[model samples]
Target: MRITTKKLVLCALMTAIVFLITFTPFLQIPSPMTQGYYNIGDAAIMIAAILLGRKVGFIAGGIGSLLADVVTGYYIYAPATLIVKGIEGYIIGAIANKKNGVPSRLRQAVAVTAGGLEMVLGYFIYQATVIRMINPTLGMASIIADIPGNLIQGAISAVLALVFLTVLYRTNTVKNLLR
Candidate 1:
């Protein structure tokens, strides 16, 4: 596909936005036991995935999430962020591309599922590889403890994405840009 300046700018803008949102409370937080950390950045990634297709979505999500990690000094999570966010975007975009139903609902569901997977997988990778080496068997508890948080994040992101998309769909700016 021929890349347009508009698409490139759109991708970069959303990536930076996601990175900033990752620092905000509306985004995921770092803690072993905190359940229900809502990540608004995931919604941004999901929106990009739904609108821009898988390749673009994955690039945006991966880069944005990595930048967030760097800016936040969460280097331990950077590798996982890159891989997991890319997967999340690809998963959501793939499902949306195949959808033949209530596209909005399908997009929400797909995005949430993708976000959940990203959190869970990322936590597992980061803990097992980095955290657990320092404290053995701790990774297991870390994974288990994150289940609720991942679920909560997923649910919140889904709702937020749905609402945001609904509003954006109504606007001529998003309609022209996203479509």
Candidate 2:
């Protein structure tokens, strides 16, 4: 794809927003399993995906989240975060962009749900396999324990993203951006 100034600027801005939100303490809930906190950075990821398309969303979400992980001393999770978040963003963008512009509410909901599932399951696998490499049993246990927290975080992020998307659509922010 040709890189235009607007796309470049928006990508950078979204990356910065994702990093800032991911790094913020107020929105973080400490996770004992991964030692990295759960955050609402996904809200920005969802927005980027819906507005920017898959490539931009993947880059913004992945690199932004990876930077946050590195800076926050969750170095071991950086790689996993990049992959998981990138996939999540890609999934959202792909589904949301199926129509001419932004998708309908039902489609958006489906996209978010699928993307959220990716986030939840991706992290769970990382925790289960990579983090607890020594004791697979303990890893399994930890995965089980983390289920509730991950579910809650995913649900909250999805709700916030959808609400924000709705408002943006109603205000023609999405339409204006597309044109």
Candidate 3:
């Protein structure tokens, strides 16, 4: 089926929200340095993937993350961030959207798993194969460091998705497309 106008509108809004929250953080933690701060942008990535599917997810994830990086004084990491976020969004979106009648619960679990795995996989690939300057230990160390945060973000995002998607479904704004 052709991509519908409604999907485009929602995707645009979600992408905007991703950009907004990447900076504001409906939830955030503090640290002495930049590395210590955490944001829900990744959850936005997961949401885009799940709701809009891979293509839209990729676009939203890349642009949203790149914008966040630029705005947050993280321009150095912007390029890599965009690619990794795009991949994370696409993979999760692809998994969450299935042709078969998979239940929403199962798809949500899958999205969570995929979200965490993306952090693990992207870190390893970028560190080991593509670039090492950012973090020489990016190969495995990045994954190790990211696990707890990623899990927390992933679970939170899943819960949020359930709530938001349910609301949309009820309003007939979006299908229980998640289901």
Cα deviation of 91, candidate 1, in Å: 0.9
Residue range 1-179, candidate 2, lDDT tens digits: 58989899899999999899898888888888656688999989988988888887798889999999999888988999999999999998898885576588898888888888999999888888887884555657667788788777778888999999889988966667766
CA error at residue 146 for candidate 3, angstroms: 4.4
Per-residue lDDT of 1-179 in model 1, one digit per residue for the tens?
Answer: 78989888888887887778776754466564522233667777887877676776788888898888777777766787788888887777777773442366755676667665776677666666766675565647656777777677666776787788778767786656755
lDDT by residue (45-141, candidate 3, tens digit) is 7767776778777878888878887887867557877887788788877888856543386776677577657754664455455545654654455
Best by TM-score: 2
Q: Look at candidate 3 and tell me the lDDT of residue 58.
A: 85
Q: Report every candidate's CA lDDT.
A: 0.71, 0.85, 0.67
The regions of model 3 sitting more than 4 angstroms off are 1-8, 30-36, 98-103, 124-143, 175-179
Question: How many clashes would you count in candidate 1?
Answer: 0
Extract clashing residue pairs from model 1.
none
The C-alpha TM-scores of every prediction are: 0.82, 0.92, 0.73
lDDT agreement of model 3 with the native: 0.67
| Candidate 2 accuracy as TM-score | 0.92
Model 1 TM-score relative to the real fold: 0.82
Candidate 2 vs candidate 3: which has greater TM-score? 2
